[model samples]
Target chain A: EPEVTQTPSHQVTQMGQEVILRCVPISNHLYFYWYRQILGQKVEFLVSFYNNEISEKSEIFDDQFSVERPDGSNFTLKIRSTKLEDSAMYFCASSEEGLGNQPQHFGDGTRLSIL
Target chain B: AQTVTQSQPEMSVQEAETVTLSCTYDTSESDYYLFWYKQPPSRQMILVIRQEAYKQQNATENRFSVNFQKAAKSFSLKISDSQLGDAAMYFCAYSPNSGNTPLVFGKGTRLSVIA
Candidate 1:
């Protein structure tokens, strides 16, 4: 079965540095999302993207975060400045359509470690 | 706002035994979707099963099944003939049936299958 794929399974960056996490959603998927989980915490929604624009974002998704669908297949999340609290597992998910009734498929998360 | 709650933080089951994980949610929306996702040690989030709020029939996938109580806003996952591979972190998530809604996830229950 086709699945969402994320690059740089583990990323280590210095505090205050910029980091970009990349994802390649299923070819036919129309909606994409980014979520994060602090160690021992619940997974929290970050942002949702559709039609090359952000559809919705959470309070956690502040000024530092931005998402882009730079190409037909690649969706990326960039953090302008990494903080120590930013250390967590970042996950990418996608669904065939934007309607919430459809199941979203998640990728193996990228573990972001800020030093 | 929708909130998913997983009462049990951890659970253990003997191999081949049946185990149930409890999940409850508070949502104002009449139509939505509930999902159970499994994350193994690798931390790959895998969709185990999903239930549509409008459907009265329970959703089942092979050995995995759900008891969905729409009126009570309760959804529980039942794993039958549990195996060693079933040891993982299980998350209960909810999403409204709206355009591009992000999934809201519970804190998750850690399930351990003992041999």
Candidate 2:
């Protein structure tokens, strides 16, 4: 089965710095997403991308968080001016058609550590 | 706003036995999807099973099955013949039926399969 691949399994950054996490979604998938899970916390939705644009985002996806499908294969999440609380495991997921029954496949996740 | 809840933080089952993990969600949307995902030690997210809100019959995949109660907004995962490999953190997730939406996940339940 095809799988979503993410780069840099682990990342470390300083407070108020910028970090970009990159992911290559399944080749045929049309919808992509970025989610984060704080240690010992629930996985929270950050943003969803379709047609090279953001379709929906949660409150946690504020000005600091941005997602871009810069190319057909690469989906990236940029966190500008990261804070200590921004440290978490960031997962990238993709769905074939974004239908109800279609399951979203996820990558191993990029663990971001902000000091 | 939609919220996915996993009441049990941890559960254990003897090898070859059965185990059930509970999940509940609050969503006003009539059309949506629910899923159970397993995150193993490698931190790779794997889709265990999924259920559509419109389907009255629960979905079963191999030894994994779901008990979906649409009226009560409840969805539970039952793993039959649990094995040592079944030990992982299970997350219940929800997403909209249509459009490009990201999944909202519950605080995971950790399952330990004892030998």
Candidate 3:
């Protein structure tokens, strides 16, 4: 089965530095998403992307966060200024369609660690 | 707003035995989707099963089955003939029927299968 792929399984960055997490969703998928999980906490939605635009975002997705589909296959999430609280497991997911019933395929996740 | 709750923080079961992970949600929307995702030590989020709110029959996949009580707003996952590989953190998630809505996940339940 095809799977979503994320790069830099673990990322360590300075508190004030910028960080970009990359994901390659399934080739045929049309919708993409970003979610985060704090250690021992529930997974939180960050943003959803479709047609190169953000479809929805949570309050947790503030000014510091932005998502871009720079190319056909790569979707990226950039944090303008990282903070200690931003350290978490960032996951990428995709679905064949934007329909609610479609199952989202997930990647292993990128563990972001802010120093 | 939608919220998912996994009351059991951790559970244990003997290999070849059966176990159930409980989940409840608060959602005003009549049509929605429920999912159970498993995350092993590797932190890869894997889709275990899914249930549609409008369906009266429970969703089952092989040894994985769900007990979905729409009236009670409960969706539970049952693992039959558990194996050591089943030891993982399981998350219950909910999403509105709208394609634009993102998923809301519970804190998760950690299952430990003993040999």
Compare the candidates by DockQ and give the number of the best one: 1
lDDT of 3: 0.94
TM-score of 1: 0.98
Better of 1 and 2 by lDDT: 1
| Runs off by more than 4 Å, candidate 3 | none
How big is the positional error of residue A64 in model 3, measured in Å on the Cα after superposition?
0.6
Against the true structure, whose lDDT is highest? 1
Clashing pairs in 1: none
> For candidate 1, what is the interface RMSD?
0.8
List the candidate numbers ranked by lDDT, top first: 1, 3, 2
As for DockQ, the candidate ahead, 1 or 3, is: 1
Native-to-model Cα distance after best TM-score fit, residue B35 in candidate 1, in Å: 0.7
Give the candidate order by descending TM-score.
3, 1, 2
How displaced is residue A100 in candidate 2, in Å?
Answer: 2.7
lDDT per residue for candidate 3 within A33-70, as digits (tens), equals: 99999998999999999999999899999999999999
Q: What tier of docking accuracy does candidate 3 attain? A: high
After superposition, the stretches of candidate 1 with alpha carbons farther than 4 Å from their true spots are none
lDDT tens per residue, model 3, B13-33: 999999999999998999999
lDDT string for model 1 (A1-115, tens) is: 9989999999999999999999999999999999999998999999999899999999999999999999799999999999999999999999999887888889999999999
Evaluation by DockQ, superior candidate among 2 and 3: 3
